[model samples]
Target: MERTLPKPKGIVIFGFLLPGILINLFIIVIPLILAIYFSLYKFTGGIMGDFVGLSNYAQLVKDGKFWNSFKNNLVITGLSIVGQLGFAFVLAIVLQSKWVKFREFHRTVIFLPVVLPAVVVGFVWTLMYNKDYGILNKLLSSIGLSSWIQPWLDDPGIVLYSVTAPIIWQFIGLYLIIFMSAIQNISSEIYEVAEIDGATGLRKAIYITLPMLADTIKVALMLCIAGNMKIFDNIFVMTGGGPGDSSTVMAQYAYNVSFGQFRLGYGSAVSIGMIILSLLLVLVIRRLMGGTNR
Candidate 1:
């Protein structure tokens, strides 16, 4: 079948887009320009000093702490891909099943965490992860698995993962909803055909659902990457990037440099580096995921 439609008018399109363009100009473009400008100078205490071009960038290149924080960001991004997306995939499938009871209620419960403040999640999980007199240890000891109970917030080796837990757990319902929405949008005729062809259960998921949901999965992965790379509040409330900086991620690290240490220029440089690294990593992932395909 052939289809025809009225062409969009240029004046009307521009009028519709003008507000968004102006907003981005102020919110994104101007700030980006200012960041670049500040990165070229030595600025501190709300004062701009000597313009040392590329020196801030040079110093950042030699900054071990910056690199360490970046490494932690990568770790979080990797874990989030598996933890959030993988868990959401399974949960969405379970909830979508015909035999499930009170599925709407379950979905509402799952999604509730998404609306909670990151600070609240952080504080709540911090108590949950406390080494002494905490719920985790009590449960483990009750199950006769006290050895499995960990110093979640204390140990440097595990603090990063501990802080990562609530961060990963918080938005899982969101990705689950995205996946479920995608799954629901799929045509029933396709499933009927799959049934006729003896596809069901795991076979149905693998052959019909997954392939059909590939685009949605890509979208979910992109959201996961962005969220993990830019995460701050919850981890800050939980760990403050500590246990000797073991839990430090790039965002919080830059913030500490900017505000805590008052090294505005250096912080700007770190922020720029984070922006670059995130773009590069996302682009690499997109390439690997065959992003150009429909």
Candidate 2:
């Protein structure tokens, strides 16, 4: 008698995938739905209160803090893109040249910051920026430029820019690696041909490298924008969103609203608004990139 082996059933296949799907729904989807629901009501002591019906959103429009936080995010995003991508691109090109010596050592030193923990970087920089006993002030004093030293984290006017420094310093290595790898994948023959045709230096970069690097640059820009949008750890560690919330970004503002001041409903609305804004901005940016596509 011939015996046939049992076949795997559709139920078994679904059973194998069900756990992950359910867990994702439980962890991500449920909270998202709850946030949207809570955005419509005023959260009270241990419970949601009467329906607010977009009052929270209206409050967002009228709130000066909300607008300030948004403006800070834009400034941070713009400056971050320029700082990170500009340095990374230059480093990638320079380091790729045969004339550069100890290339591996330079790469290691530069990329070292990328591997360091963000929390540690933040705290270290915070200490370095301390006005009374900080290295920064000490250096200025030694050079007889003592008047140049200001309370880095305490000053409202320049604190936001100061907060951005560590962020820009830390991420350049990551984008450098990415841009370098993209540069490498472009066949060497094209570059050689360009050189033979008297196209070198900035001509080769502007006409050849830039056109070929369109996609990679777009990815880098998107990552930079998204990261700046959700930035928290460094600012939180250094400033605690303080100096009168001068350095507050959207994420920090959401946390302060939700937990610090106990305004859960308004916080949820802010979060929802942030998500919508992020999505819209990304779409707009991506569309712009497409229009300039080579």
Best by TM-score: 1
Q: List residue ranges in candidate 1 displaced over 4 A.
A: 1-19, 292-294
**What lDDT tens digits, residue by residue, belong to model 2 across residues 1-294?**
999989989999899999999999999899999999998899944866989898999998788897788888888888899999999988988898878999889888889898998899999999999999999999999999989999999999999999999999999999999998999999999999999999967787889888798889999998998888888889989998879979998889999999999989999998888887777788899998783444
Instruction: Give the whole-model CA lDDT for all candidates, comma-separated.
Output: 0.89, 0.89
lDDT of 1 by residue, 215-258 (tens): 89998898899889988998899889998789899999999999
Against the hidden reference, what TM-scores do the models get? 0.92, 0.88
The positional error of residue 253 in candidate 2, measured at the CA in angstroms, is 1.0
- Lowest-scoring 10 consecutive residues by lDDT in candidate 1? 39-48
Inter-residue clash pairs, candidate 1:
none
